[model samples]
Target: MVQPAPYLLGRFLDPIFAIGVGTLSYIQYERNTHREPGHTLYDLLQKKFFATKEQTQEKK
Candidate 1:
């Protein structure tokens, strides 16, 4: 008995997914490298979690 053709369209999906993931990674890397040093998550957490009373009051 002859076998039916494999689903060829499914093969194209992996490369498309890879390109999308790679593009996103490059964008994220560029943003991280170009950002100011003080914009890191640790600094952000410190600013949010450890703000002085005057600093907190200023938001009002």
Candidate 2:
């Protein structure tokens, strides 16, 4: 009637993982609240990754 090592390890680590995720979410919330009115982290990343030719020209 003994559980395997992986199962025991998962049970022990689940709480830690949840806490880490919660902390990251809180930090993201704080950052978003203080950002400029029309921009977000996702928008910045999207513009960086998928900029149009005109957008690129404007930067130069």
Candidate 3:
């Protein structure tokens, strides 16, 4: 007797998708969490991740 089997591609993708979305939401939640210092989130990301600091600085 033979048994039915599942496809390999779907199994691989399921965990990848779950972890990807979970990590993204977790980061977003942490980003909004409380802070001990007086600083906006825009500043924090720049210091930590080296992310973009300024989009458009006004002319002097």
Candidate 4:
């Protein structure tokens, strides 16, 4: 159906769009922020992936 096309397009594009936005943000953050131990995207993702909600709350 015609409606399905727009829905499918959105589903496919959302993640791609999010990646672009996140990459741009990460570049800006790295440029402006201090260099810490876990500053790269890989390190940041690892920390976030492994961190518990409580630990993350403590950081914030």
lDDT (Cα, tens digit) per residue for candidate 4, span 1-60? 355434534887988988898999987888688667677776778786988888889988
Q: How does residue 22 of candidate 4 score in lDDT? A: 94
- Give lDDT tens digits, candidate 1, residues 1-60: 999767534678867888888978866885878867777655687889999999889989
lDDT scores in order? 0.77, 0.78, 0.65, 0.78
Worst 10 residues of 4 by lDDT: 1-10
Candidate 3 lDDT over 24-55, as tens digits, reads: 87668757885446365556676567634453
Top model number, TM-score: 2
Report the C-alpha displacement of residue 1, candidate 1, in angstroms: 21
Q: Quote each prediction's TM-score.
A: 0.41, 0.43, 0.40, 0.41
Instruction: Return the TM-score for candidate 2, rounded to 2 decimals.
Output: 0.43
Query: Which portions of model 1 miss their true places by more than 4 Å?
Result: 1-9, 35-60
Q: How would you encode candidate 2's per-residue C-alpha lDDT over 1-60 as one tens digit per residue? A: 998556534886978888888978965995967977547656776798988999999999
**Candidate 2: C-alpha lDDT:** 0.78
Consecutive 10-residue window with the lowest summed lDDT within model 3: 51-60
Better of 3 and 4 by lDDT: 4
Query: Candidate 4 — what's its lDDT?
Result: 0.78
| Shift in Å, residue 30, candidate 2 | 5.2
Estimate the Cα RMSD of every predicted model relative to the unseen true structure: 9.7, 6.8, 8.2, 6.3
